[model samples]
Target: MMRFIKPFIMPAVALAAWGTALPASAQDKGPIRIGVPTAIQLQIGRDTQTGVRMAIDEINAKGGVLGRKLEMVVADETENPEQGIAAIKKLTADEKVDVMIGGYTSGVTLAQLPHIARSKTIYMEVGAASPAITQRVKSDYDNYKYIFRSFPINAAHQARGLVDFISGMLKDEMKIQNIAIVGENAKWVQDLVPILKKGATEAGANVKLSEFFDTSTSDFSPLLAKVKDSGAQYLIVILSHASSDIFVKQWYDARFPIPIGGIDVKGQDQDFFSRVGGKAISETVGNFAVRAPLTAKTLPFWDAFVKAAGTAPVYTGVGGYDAVHIYAEAVERAKSLEPDAVIKELEKTDYTGVAGKMVFDETHDVKAGPGFVNLLFAQWQADGKREVVWPKQIATGKMIPPPWMQVQ
Candidate 1:
C-alpha cells in the first residue's frame, strides 16, 4: 500500500529555532537538524529549499528517522562568496546542524569548503560542479571525508557526455564538425574545458577556437562575432554564471548560423524558455532530469514539487530532494548521529533517486556513465518544450539545428 504524501508549508520560525538536545537515549529524543545554506534569491536556492523541506516533511510524516523527527534551519548563501562562507559558519557553528545540504556557484562553494571541513559536519553538497571539491577529498581524506557532492556530477565528469553528444549528434545529423568552446571564467567551467577539448579532439572533431569570459561580461556580441569569424560549425558553451539569457538571445537574434550546445546552467531551469521569452529554441544544454520516469521515485517527486512550488524544479531542486533522503538513510543504517558512522553508510549507498543509481566512488563524487548516472543533453524545442536528445535509448527527440542551419 502506498502512503499519501502531503504538501509542506514553510515554517514560521525556522531560522530562530533549535532542536531539543540533552543526554539522550539510543534513539535521541531531539530532532535531527538539517541545515541548508544556499543562495535563497536564486532559483537554485528557492527550489532546493522546497525539495529539502519536502523530504523532511515526508520523513516526519512517516514517524521520522530512528524515532527522531527531522527539522531544517536555513541560511541564505547569496551569490557572494563572503556571504556563502558566513552562511556555512552560521549553519555549522551557531546552528549546530547534524547534516548540511545545499550549495550553488562554484566560487562560493569553494570558499565554504574549508569551513565545512573545520566544522566536521557531513555536508551533502547538492549543487556546485567544481571537481576541486571532491579532489580535495581524494587528495586528503582525513579532513575532507566529511564532504560529499550528492548531485550534478563534477564538471570534468560532465565533459565526457557533452563532448560525445556534440561531436556525435551534430556530425551525424547535420554533418557539422568544427566546435568553438566558450566558457564562463569560473572554476567548474575551467575544470570542464580541458576535458572537453581532449575528448572532442580525440573524437575527430576540430576545435576552431577555445576561449573563456568573465561572468559579468554582459555583451556577447563581440564574442559572437569572434565565433562567427572563427568559422566554427557549432558553439559549445560552458556557461553557469555568465549572462546566458543575453548571450542566447544574441545568438538567436544575430543568426550566427552556429548552433549552441553544452552546459548552460541557467537553461536547465524548467521555465527557461518562457523566462527568456522563448529565445532558447534549438539550444541544447546538459541536464539532470526532464520529468521522465527514470526511476520509481522520479515522477512522484516531480509531481509533488510542482504541487508545492507551483513550478517545475530546476536541477539542484532534485539534488536537494535526493540529498535529504540519502542523509536520512545513512543515519538510519548507521543508527547513530555521529558523522563518521553515517559517512560509512553513505559510501555504500546504492539508492535509486530521481536521476539514477547514486553510488559514490572512492573520491566521494557520484559515479557517472552506464548503469550509473549519465549526463543528459536536452534541447529547448519550439514553444518552450524540452526534449532529451542524447543517449538514444532515453532520448525523447532528436537534436535539431537552428532554422539557419537546417538539416537536409
Candidate 2:
C-alpha cells in the first residue's frame, strides 16, 4: 500500500505544479495568436490593419482555423524600420505569436526578416513589394523559409506591363518617340529602373532620360525643367505615396507639359488623389494592380471589404485582406502551428485570392496572373473618377490625356 501510494502521489504532485505554472495554457486550448505590426498613422497602414481585422472577424465568425478562435496582437511600427523590428521582436518573443502579418514599406519589411527567421515564426508580408524579399529567396533560400509575400514583386510584372502599354499607346495611339523615367531615390523604385528600362527598349521606346530625385526633395522645379528640356514626350513618375503627390503638384505648378504616366499613380488611396485635387490630378495616367473600372473579378472583393471596413477599399487594404486569408489557408493545409510546415503548405498553394490567382513559386513569391488582373493603366478624368484606358479588355474608357498634355 505505501509503495503504490508513493508513486501515485508523486505523479499527481508533478501534474498539479505544471498545471498551476501554466494555467491559461491549460484552460483555453483553442486560441491561436497572430501578431500584426501596423503603421497606424499612415493611410495605407490604417487601411491594411482594418482589412486584416475584417478578415479575422469573418474567419472567427465562420469557425476559425483548426477548431480554434483566432486572436491578433497588434503593434504600431510607426512606418519606421527600427520601430518595426522592435515591434516584431516584442510580438514573437514576448507574446509568442504563431504568425505575423503587416508591412507597408519595403525598408520596414526588409528590417524585420532577420528577426522573423531567428524566431522561426511565419510572417506574411501584406504590402511591401520590394523584389529583394523574393529575389533573395533564390540565393539564400533557407533564410527565407519563414517569410512569404502576398503583393506582386515590386516593378517586375507591373513595370513590364507599363512599358509595353505606354510604348504601344505612344506608337499606335499617341505617336510619341521619347520617354523619361522619373522616380524618388528609394529602394522601391531604384530596383525598378533597370526592369523598366529593359521593357521600354523591348517595346521600341527610347528612354531619353532616367532621373532619380531624393525622397526629401520638396522642390521639383529643377527636375521638371530638366525633363522639359530633354524633349521627352512621356514622363514616367515612380515614387511613394507622399512624394508622388508632391511631384505631381509640382509638375503642374512648373507648367511641365509632358504627359506623365507610371506605376505609382493609381494604386494609392482616394486621399492621395484628393490631396492633389481633382483638377490637378485629372488626366494623369498610371498603372495599378486592377483597372479603375472594378471588373466582376475585382468588384466582389471591393464590396466585401467596403462592407466589412465601412470605408472605400484601397490597394493596401486588398493586399491585407488577401494576406490574412492566404495565411489561414496555409495554416489549414499545414494542419499544425509550426512555421516549417506552413512554409511548405504556402509553397504548394495555388489560391485564387482577391489579388487574383496567387501561386507561390519555388522562391516563395506569389505569381499574380497575366494581363490587367495583375496590372492595369488608368487615367484620372475630370469627373473625379479614374478610368481604365489600357488593356482594352477591361478599359472603361479610352486613353485621354490632359489639356496640358495633348500631343504636339
- Alpha carbon lDDT of residue 319, candidate 1? 93
Off by over 4 Å in 1: 1-28
Question: For all candidates, what are the clash counts?
Answer: 0, 0
**Candidate 1 local Cα displacement, residue 242, angstroms:** 0.8
lDDT of 2 by residue, 1-408 (tens): 000101011111001010112234432676788777877676666677766766676666556677676777777787688998998999999999988887777888888888888988888877677788776678777876888777654557667767767677675677887898888777777778888888888888888899888878888888888888888888888877446666777776666777777766333566556777654454444544443334333555565555555556656676676777778877777767677788888888765555467777776776754722376667776656777777677778776666665545
Q: Could you say which candidate leads in lDDT?
A: 1
Candidate 2 vs. true structure, TM-score:
0.87
Give the C-alpha lDDT of model 1.
0.84
Most accurate candidate by TM-score: 1
The lDDT per prediction is: 0.84, 0.69
Give the CA lDDT, 0 to 100, for residue 182 in model 1. 94
Please give, for residues 48-82, the per-residue lDDT of candidate 1 as tens digits: 88888888887776667777788888898888999
Q: Which residue pairs show collisions in model 2?
A: none
